[model samples]
Target: MEENHRLQVIEEGPYADPGRYRRLVGRLVYLTVTCPDLTYVIHILAQFLKKPQVKHWEAALRVVHYLKGCPGQGILLTANTDLTLSSYCDADYQTCPRTRRSLSGYVILLGGSPIAWKIKKQKTVSLSSAEAEYRAMRYTTGELKWEHELLSYFGVRHDTAIPLFCDNQAALHIAANPFFHERTKHIDADCHFVRDALKAGLIATFKIHTSNQVADIFTKSLGGPPFSYLLRKLGIRDLHALT
Candidate 1:
């Protein structure tokens, strides 16, 4: 296995070639199937593949190094868990330096294990953090519905509303209050799917503090300590402990 630092190429180069870089990124995308930790990093690196400069290659290599250090890390599912379904969602409002589009990410858990997750750039640029988060909640609700249906196929049933945790109090308030139309009139209609779901009793939204926002891991980069903390909270355990 390669060390984390060794994976990065420090030397500067204009290396305008993209063929090799594309192949490398393609391989990384394939690895994301069983290695969810690399999904965000790999998605970010894939954006720079068209003009593969030294910086882009260095970032991709860093992911390779990180993977090498924790090759045994992966999600684990246990038997005899509860039927409770819950999710955490978040967004980085206008985080894209170029287009200013927000990035939406969420993780859905069945009992104690994460069964589905996603991280993607929003289709539209949101005017405020509250709006961005609301949009993310909508996307997450759509995913939750799909998961609910899939579980039904297997005879697993959840009678109660699926709870979605969001760190933004303002967003949670907006979803719960129907009279806040004056404030939210500017937001896209599609982004209001969460509110509609709330009305139908399909899902429930709750406010969570920043410290407990597990979905933060998918939306932005974090220092080693906080990152590891959330990873463990998501049910990712050290391979040695399981053995």
Candidate 2:
């Protein structure tokens, strides 16, 4: 969690055991459902799944060690909170070392508590950062629809348009503009879906500064201060001690 720390594929020799590496990675993946802070790190480790190396194993161990040191960390919730949904979406363009695909992530908050979040690689390569971010916003918008259905099953009504935040202004423009620009000419199906959502009033897109983009944590490795700041913004609580 140091400033600008990055995990790279290092293959000095064979890993002690490929099986153990997979097992550890699997556990970490499951941990991500509750431990949002671990999502980006686990995604990095997963790239070398078939043939993990010494450095990958060591990096995985670091996540485990950090968890051991902060066992009391967890998502905090409030009863009878507002049922409205709001999401922050972001993308790291061409972050995948192997495929050069963009990394997309979104964090959805219900009544100000994180109810759903995901860290995924984009299905196709993005030619621009705005395209990658717009794709991420569409993914978040689709998730909002599913989540609204889930809420309905439990007698909760989420009829209002969900607010979606992004750090890229061009992506927001792409989501609402009826006219296409040469810059967005080659965009994929996701761009159309997001524009449709915006026109249909299913989601509201807004521009936010990079520092306040909580979804940033889910997309890449961050320094300790910023990482801790975003975790707090997501309502993740530390029961063991003060921040």
Candidate 3:
């Protein structure tokens, strides 16, 4: 999907074949297991499966065209022994025009190799960008906690606080600060789940510049150069590409 493009519910416009669109999106869902880059786009297209518009189908086909260009492009799991877990979490505030909901995403890496990721629409509308980002952090923290426990099962223990990177300073403050503020009064208590995790030393929130935020690729559409740059940062590669 292009950065400028936004998919929405088109009620009056010409619609596409629903069956075809659903099938394509269904297959794309499977591709996401190995193609983390396609996760966001597929998540967006899947929302319109029941009543897809022409624009939606076109976007789906565009994804197919992109896959054809580099069918072998995929994540590169390194052989390095470093088992540290790090994560990047982000949100696109009010990205859904119809519902005014935000898009949240996170990528979890194990020793520079992506082990898990997720892109989801917030269940409730967030009044502020900080709230949206904080919600995303909470989600990422839950997954991070689960992954942390799972590693212990495999006899891999991390004694230090795992880093959770975010571009929003306000959200980080919310997690680190124990007191509530006027602006954050409306945010649900559960949204501060990351704060508890922080107190327990399960994770540490770090400020990352938006430009270096690799999770941006999972939250919103981006232009070509930055997209490729982040893809490389994600440890994705095309080993079979012709020289």
Candidate 4:
């Protein structure tokens, strides 16, 4: 399986049937329980389930090849790190070529290691970059709230609000203030819940420059250097190193 993942099986002859391709992708997705790194790639590939082309197959194969080359990669939860919660939020504005919808992504850290992360397409189209970012922040806030509740159930009490980092200044401003303008009036009421959370001190928003936005890797495809950099920043290391 490792060897197959590493080999770039180029598409040849007729395209694979959509049903078969969907099944293969479904099986791969089930593996995400232990392979979060594959989440974004698989989700992106799943978009073409209805009409997968040879090019799409090649792309999926590349993801498998990436996994094969780094077979020992996995998440680790250490006892030594602090338990304070911090989150990074980001979005790709209108990245979907087919739907023109933005993608929202976030990573939550328990101390310095990643504990939760996700990449999902926004349900509605955003009119501006700030709007897209705000939507992303909302999603991250929801995740943080859920994590907070789960920890409480385990008798772990976190007294303070989680600090969420974002690259967009305008989005940060919007979250800090409740007054809505004509520009922001069109945003759905549900998505604006983050604003209330910010006002109530349930979550805090901090500005981070694009260079330091670790969630960037989840929102879109990046170059080799940036991609590797963000992965390390998220505290993902070779699993073999510990063994």
Candidate 5:
């Protein structure tokens, strides 16, 4: 997807064949398992499956062209023996052109290799970027907790807090502070577990610079340079690329 291009639902337009578009998007969906770079664009394309337009078909084909450039591109988990777990979470505030819903995304890494990732739209409109980021932190905390327990079940001991990095300072403050202020009252009460996880030593919140926020690739469309940079940060590679 183009970084500046935003897809909108057009009620009356030259529509593409829904069947073909749906099948193409489905194959793209499966590609996401090995192509983190495709996650955001495919999510956008999947939205108009029922009423795809020619523009949408073009966008889908753009992804196919991208794949043609490097068919062997895929994530490469390192063989490092460290059992450390860390996560990066981020949110693109109100990016959906039609619904004004925020998109939240996170990537969980085990021993510096990504093992789980997700991108989702917030259920309710966030009145502030901090709230949207806080919600993303909460969702990531839940996943961290589950991952922690799963590792423990297999006798992996993680004595230290799992570091959860976010680019928003306000969200980091909210996650570290236990008290609820009037400004934070609008956020869902359930999201407070991010703070709980902090106190329970299950996770620790850290402030990261936006440029270093690798999870940005999952939440929004990025240009080629930054996209390739973050993809390299994830340890993804093309094993068959010419040397």
Candidate 6:
């Protein structure tokens, strides 16, 4: 884990026991609910449940060891911060070797602190990166709406549209504009929910450059500096560790 670790199913190793692997990874899936740093690796391991190999098992064990290194690190929600809702969404276009499907990830922040995050493979293959990114935007909007409703029950009404940050300008434009054209014809009708969310004045899509896109960490493997950068941004602090 000290290195920029990425996971792939290693077939040359002996087959691993499915029961143990599933149990271990199942727990990690729940851990990912609050531990966004482990999202990408744990999600990769979950795919091989039926026919896990030695390398896959080893990778999962490595994750267990990594957990020991920072059991106390987690998101800290303070009451003093603002209640504004913002989100960052990103995708790894066609990075899944087996299905050739892209990965979509989004992070929801409450008052500049991360409250929720998730990453998973797209259900269908996307023909373009823009399409993949657009799909992620739609999902982000959905999460925003759900959170908005929950906050409304508490009498916290946001007078402004929630900001959904995305790195693809084409995807941003597609969500903001009502025009229909040949380039976006292949995208499914359901994916166009982003447009509806925009039209309703419930969401605002904005372009952010990749370097500052914190959601980028959730979708792909990152080096030490980049990973550390995101960890800091997510407010993940090792409270007792030495600086």
| Alpha-carbon runs more than 4 Å astray in model 3 | 9-12
lDDT of each: 0.80, 0.86, 0.90, 0.78, 0.86, 0.83
Error of 3 at 182 (Å): 2.1
Q: Which pairs, if any, clash in model 6?
A: none
Better of 5 and 6 by lDDT: 5
What are the TM-scores, per candidate, against the unseen true structure? 0.90, 0.93, 0.95, 0.88, 0.95, 0.92
lDDT digits (tens) for residues 133-230 of candidate 5: 98898889889999999999999989999999999999987776777887699884745677778778999888999888999999988888888889
Clashes of 6: 0
Candidate 3 minimal-lDDT segment of 10 residues: 8-17
For lDDT, candidate 2 versus 6, the one ahead is 2
Cα lDDT tens digits for candidate 3, 1-243: 877675785555656468988888999999999889999999899988878888888899999999999878998888874899999999999999999999999999999989999999999999999999998998899999999999999999999999999999999888878888787786757446777788889998899999999999999999999999999999999988776
Cα RMSD (angstroms) for every candidate in the order listed: 3.9, 1.8, 1.5, 4.6, 1.5, 2.1
lDDT (Cα, tens digit) per residue for candidate 1, span 1-243 = 122322223346655667888999999998777666676777677776666677777777887788777877888777888978999999989888778899999999988788888899998788889989988888899999899989999998978889999999888888877665665876747446777888777798888988788888887877788888888888877675456
Clashing pairs in 5: none
* Cand. 6 TM to true fold: 0.92
Best candidate per lDDT, number? 3
Clashes of each: 0, 0, 0, 1, 0, 0
Error of 6 at 239 (Å): 2.0
Relative to the unseen true structure, what is the Cα RMSD of model 1?
3.9
Task: Judge candidate 4 against the unseen true structure and give its global Cα lDDT, from 0 to 1.
Answer: 0.78
Candidate 2: the clashing residue pairs are none
In model 4, state the lDDT of residue 215. 90
Residue-level lDDT tens digits of model 6 in 64-170 = 98889887888878779889999999998998777789999999998988887889789999998998998888788889989999999999888898988999998
Reference-based lDDT, residue 30, model 2: 88
